[model samples]
Target chain A: MPTVTLSLGKDSYDVHVMNGALDRLGDLVHRSRLTGHAAIVTDTTVVRHYGERARLALEEAGYTTSLHVVDAGEQSKSLATVETLASELVKAGVDRSGFIVALGGGVVGDLAGFTASIHYRGIPFVQVPTTIMAQVDSSVGGKTAVNIPAGKNLVGSFHQPRLVVVDPLTLTTLPARVIREGMAEMVKHAAIRDAAMLYDIRALAEETELGFTLSTIERLPDLIARNIAIKARVVEEDEKETKDVRAFLNFGHTLGHGIEAAVPYGELLHGEVVSLGMRAALFLSEKYAGLSAHASEDVLSTLKALELPLVLPEGIDPATALEKTLTDKKFQAGMIRFVLLGALGQPTISDDITIDDLKEALALLQRPA
Target chain B: MPTVTLSLGKDSYDVHVMNGALDRLGDLVHRSRLTGHAAIVTDTTVVRHYGERARLALEEAGYTTSLHVVDAGEQSKSLATVETLASELVKAGVDRSGFIVALGGGVVGDLAGFTASIHYRGIPFVQVPTTIMAQVDSSVGGKTAVNIPAGKNLVGSFHQPRLVVVDPLTLTTLPARVIREGMAEMVKHAAIRDAAMLYDIRALAEETELGFTLSTIERLPDLIARNIAIKARVVEEDEKETKDVRAFLNFGHTLGHGIEAAVPYGELLHGEVVSLGMRAALFLSEKYAGLSAHASEDVLSTLKALELPLVLPEGIDPATALEKTLTDKKFQAGMIRFVLLGALGQPTISDDITIDDLKEALALLQRPA
Candidate 1:
């Protein structure tokens, strides 16, 4: 598959998606014009799978490497983890010229990318996302962060990575639920910017149902690249999330992040909550953005085909979710800038999203259609 | 006094150096176009002195204000303080639209500016520097940081402030030693960029001896503004410290910071060490950069006029200091990249400095010329 280049002038970088790209990670990163030492920040679980391969590839390419593995869970995404990783990198003699390789899912990517952002007042880093969610969303943009007690990603910088290498082969090792998490972001991309990509996503969903090996699917790499292209375009338009164009990427995240926080930490994964959030947003889109009911159904059905949840979970409270949106980072200055679609593939940020409208949206998510 | 506008295109900001600016800090910041709430992050000492005045000014300017005070001194420049400040801001309803007023010296500026940099992925911050060290140096460049156990300023970002309000009146409360700490940087700026500024510094030193009130001197504001202008010009050339142009500002810091770590904290003030370091750098400048001995003597005489030490301390180990330089952030890729001077005001970066030369410089500092 061809590489997707995210154009941000001086901060521009490429996202490479291929079947066997993981083994060629060093060469791709080298092509990005980074040299010298490489700090490979991965989690224990991922280190067991591909750590040696990654280190060996970099070492072979004349780049010295050190592997620093954290615990394999969301628990490791904290300021403490960042401090520990920074100490380890310093101990390993990593300097300003060195680059970090975030070689895991979103947790490792966020942790390592953020570490790179502050280490020596910012250094270069490459993203080698091993999960679908990270491959399609987190690794493509410059948003690197760790969860704080206040909220997720509250302490971070917009530090763009030097490169991104996505290997579809890594998805074969993931469970169905994890794969579905990444599909949620893909569906978001289709809903926000590319209605035509929904057709490709639906076809991929069918291939999953047919039990085809994920890496063997002919269009898997291309589909990931397409999602990255959408992300790249949005980021290019507004790299700092200052403009509404980038805020449109929060199509499902505004309510989704709120619902995620309202519940217990591990009760629901990020993408699952986003799936539910998307349903509520679809309802709002029809009412507010003049989105057609048929267009909303097409997106909902596509999400359904990917085995994502459309209804709110039983233990979650609608009132708590609505209140939590007020604390969401997207909740700017008491205004819930809700992202509504004019149609499938057309997103618009709504400044008039009242608390009552949010209540109505959350209330609609209580039961199936 | 007129404002010194440090122009870096979109990141340009004015450095106001009037004696009474602190009383009008809110108006200055408001002129910078920051609105909503203002979180004034100060220290216990500064708050006791001017916190109420600052708060009242901002409130009078139509900004709801909150005061968050940390323990005074450098011990508070830690990651723990950052985490605490972040939670406090979140609790105080300080959001993206709100700005932070760093209302003390370098410590408060760094802590609050760093907090602002990461708060909501960064927000506008105004610098209300109460000490000469901050007003002339730290506040102008937007180099915000907190010290780590590994190194001072090891983790930080180059988040520029929207405005810097430098009230020279604050220097009235500082002891002579505290005043001299800032003078070291003044001397450094003069040595690196403005040789004529040395004459003004010598005159200021005479005024300090002749019992003139610190804030009553007519040229005080212009002196501060001149230092800021030099710093602003260097930062404009290399905002991220990516070029050697910015490194020239570190003319005395290479050995100065290392020597600082070699000794116990608080034993020798920052400028004292830099004064000693400047003497050593002068030796090297004469040896390698062909800086005339007359020019070197001119700088040494200024340090003498300011009562800055030109000799190493009794207890500090030169070897340990040299070893600490290896860990300095400027020690990139095993090269020293020491900033040198070809003349009084012409600085250059030399990558050819060897360890033996550094040893000789340390040795030179062991005795007074």
Candidate 2:
């Protein structure tokens, strides 16, 4: 097992990555001293797959486990879902000393984490991420939130999890498309802070089974450990994302969140939108951030080879998309700031772009004739 | 002007108290470096009285001010109120950099503070508390929340305002009953942490005008300053009430919140509920935590003299009222912990009581035959 600690003073917690670590959950929970009733928040898909195993593990560990299965999609990431989960927690008698274990993908992680954040003014929670997307990204950061009607993640809190148990073996049952979607975020982390990891991921993408094989799962522990370490380092220094160090983590998210907002959630997974947004951001970077043409080409090639979306979805108007960007929470002082790539392993925030420039970038993302 | 600083690391802000300082709001905003479009969230009662003055303050401060008025009452401290305020904020194009000024009593402070906390993943806000209850307690604690159907302050965050401007002159137009409501919270603060202040308040409550004369207002800055200091000390140590240091601030809030949750809000102001709750807690403290009989009598005499409620409302079943205390957010391990008075200046939390014990305490609070 590879262990990485996120230093947030008294709110600090550890992220442990290991294949088949789910069996050791009982020990981890024991060591953390979180006792009493445990509420496991997962989704329909996850409950259908490994929910029983997780329940058995917690039961064997001497916890009274209750399951709260939410609808399994991006739509589940809403205040309504958070309310439902909080109500369930209250009904289940989960209190300050009780534990909330989020056992699903990013949607479940975000929703459950947020529910824990506000329930009874906040409670302790553990993140048992069952998807690659969650293990690599959402579970490591304490940025928990629920989407509001006005914007995605517009309602939430920075409530850190007590522990993150990343069991790579859980990803075995994930659909191929889901695996591809998860890789886009990993690719984003690499593009922003780790060039060597990007090179390795690009090489791994060409293999048969698209890097979801058992051997690939073994490599995942290390990859996730490294990605989580990078995120931990950034978040530790700036937990609330106020500083530049934390802002680098939003490499592809400025436009990515806008894209996700423009489209109906569940139609496109967050990583899929992020994949295309990364390409648009790269183009903007090349034009306005003084990035070399080769770097932009490298980004496009990696995204394409991974089978992720590199262009805007059909029927999305450039003007409409540009307008959405302006309204994004990332906008400040009437300027839409973009996290641009200066080079591999480097990211910069820029707001000096004209609407015409963004329009041209969006136009370029249209599907080829 | 008496200025007190709330040192919350990077989130530190100033609490400015002065007579006629509402006119100096322009310079204060400039000092805080908050610019751009601003939204003033106040109730109709306040708008009808001090709206133009607050507007001129922001306008002279170089901010384009937009007003959002809600109904004036504790009933407005609901999620529906928050949603309405949020919609108004969105409609007014209050973006990330925009400032939200909560101007009114505790109701406006809670509603507006919560709206700012959730709007766009949190925005900077200034609390211009126009009521005594607000300046001394709600405005300083960083505990902003909206009541839910399930509980009071069931949904909210610890989003601290960038500045708290308390103009004692604002109290000049406040109704006598409203002034008394504010005094309850002030007395609660003193009873929890400062014996000297409690003694002083006891003396002040006996005077004509309930100590609201110009000399009293001149003495106001220091009294409000001391009450706020007590709260600020507790909050500074534990911003999230996870420890005993922070729970001390909840001295009268356990049963107080239950009463507020049971009654239709606005029927009994927060201070009224807190007053009754404080009496109940004192009886419990005398029985369980070694509170002296003479001290208890002094507490009753002071509250009765202030005309604050010292007994439970008529027809309220003690058992039913006790049930609400069980669901209080402060419960841990199925035990409802409460902050009880050890003496006039000392407060302590105890979980070593039964529902029957609370019922017994409640019986003591029954109306005298």
Candidate 3:
């Protein structure tokens, strides 16, 4: 099987990026010596799709796998969910020596990983991401969390998984819009780390826009693998996001999180808001970091071709967005720590984005011609 | 100020065992470069005692502090309390970069540390242990937890603190019975790691039994400091309890925890049960570990002189105690992994104990003649 290894010293693990990595999930877990009864956490929607396959894979590989299914959406990412899941883990006899498998999208991965981090002071967990959003972005990083009434992921831990099984074949099951959502992150990866990779990603997005075929299947795994490589590299260098090096990956996230908070939960997908946020960030990048208009539009058009929004969703209030940005944990010590592109491949951590700058970022959210 | 530096590599920290270290709480935080506000987590009873002094110390040292008080008992050590305290932390505006101060006994430290470990994926926490139980045992190691209905410390993490301020003066405020409870751990440390320290501990126990005076004050701090060093050494060698060297620290905890479980909550203090558990373990030690009766009696006499129980509670059932021990997380792989004393200063990890051995241990829990 194909894999990308993240070198985080003791916390290091491999991301198996393939067309059907989930089929080999049990072997991967057993190889890591994480063999025992498995308490698998997923969502209702994911259970219907790939749940039986995940259970059988582990069972065939010599594990007593127990499945705990939660609701499908982000609203299900709550402390209440974690509490109930912890009970299920205990009842299922998943000891500290056993492993937990997160078998779904971002919500499942986040809830399962966060639960694993605190259960019996944390046991090992394996990520079997069945969504493009989870495979490309959330699965690789050790950022597991659940939402509280006050905010999203206000409570969590950086509990790294023993292994991550990423199968791009899962993408065929996702909605077309959801596939585009995952593409936004791939564009962000190119914007911050490698400008050359942007060309390959844009071509892939164009193909997805038209339709899937034999070519899409052949190319999708490679696209997911490259995205995982970029993410794995960043996470290796800065595991905790302590310094600016890792913060660069937050290129479109400051405004993205702001726009996400401005609207009601589930109104706009994470990648859609991020796509629009990147447009605003690029506009600021031109003014603050001397990034060229050509490079900026090049990034924006790929998002557009994927049918992602280049502006904030209709009925979103700019003032509310600014207020939510202020409350963001990223806004440390009365400063908005924004990540902007310096050039095609140079990402800058900027603290100079004032209220006026935020207003300007909001202004750039107007629909493009 | 006196300090015992635990050399745990990345998880290394200093355990400051002194009289007036609480006054330097801010200096310690500042020295660690943990600048900014601190959220002080404590119990309602402790808030009335040292809360103002603690708040004032940080305030005078140019740090903002928010105090969160929970109900003062084992009952408060629940996920519900954690949920409420988490909300309080968010309300207090504590962010990732900010710090948390656990200021009270074991319950406060465990609750606050567990909260910090998961709050925003964990923030740096400072432990200001006000009880002897906290200073010598719970606060020294990074073993943070809260009780579930299932068991004590069934849900938790291995989150080490930024600094541990173990002010010995706090023992002065504790009830004489509480002070005796702390001595139980000191005896366990001596039983496993130092036979010579046992003599000193026995002498100290006699003094506490007789009366308290200036001699106690002058000598108690030094005794507490030595206990801290012994604990620090064990934790340094084994941070996560992955090896049996750390398992040595659980010498009497198997039966102790079982005894605690058999009794109603709040019936027997932790150290009291541990004292009784040590007696039962000593009986098992002689059989399975080849320990001499002389060493057994010597340890038993010290506990007896200190007024700790050599027998189980009057109405306790041996079968129930054995059943509770079976449910312990430590009873892994269908074996009762118990730590028994082989000799003075030599503890043995014995997994060969059968049901018959357990019955023998229960039979030995009779009051000394």
Q: For residue B283, what is the lDDT in candidate 1? A: 90
Each prediction's TM-score versus the true structure: 0.97, 0.92, 0.97
Can you tell me which runs of candidate 2 are displaced by over 4 Å? Answer: A208-211, A367-369, B196-216, B259-267, B288-290, B367-369
What does each candidate score in C-alpha RMSD? 1.6, 2.9, 1.7
Q: What's the lDDT for all of these models?
A: 0.88, 0.81, 0.85
What does the lDDT come to for candidate 1? 0.88
Q: Going through the candidates in order, what fraction of the true interface contacts does each contain?
A: 0.62, 0.42, 0.62
lDDT of 2 by residue, B239-318 (tens): 87767988887777788777776675467877888888888888889989999998877777777777888777776667
Residue A125 shift from truth in candidate 3, angstroms: 1.3
For model 3, how does the per-residue alpha-carbon lDDT over A63-125 read when each residue is reduced to its tens digit? 998999998998778878777788777778877877799999898999999888888888889
Interface RMSD for each of the candidates: 1.1, 2.2, 1.5
lDDT of 3 by residue, B55-142 (tens): 8888888999998999999888887887788888887888886889999999999999998888888888999999878888889889
Worst 10 residues of 1 chain A by lDDT: A209-218
Instruction: Name the better of 1 and 3 by DockQ.
Output: 1
Against the true structure, what is model 2's DockQ? 0.46
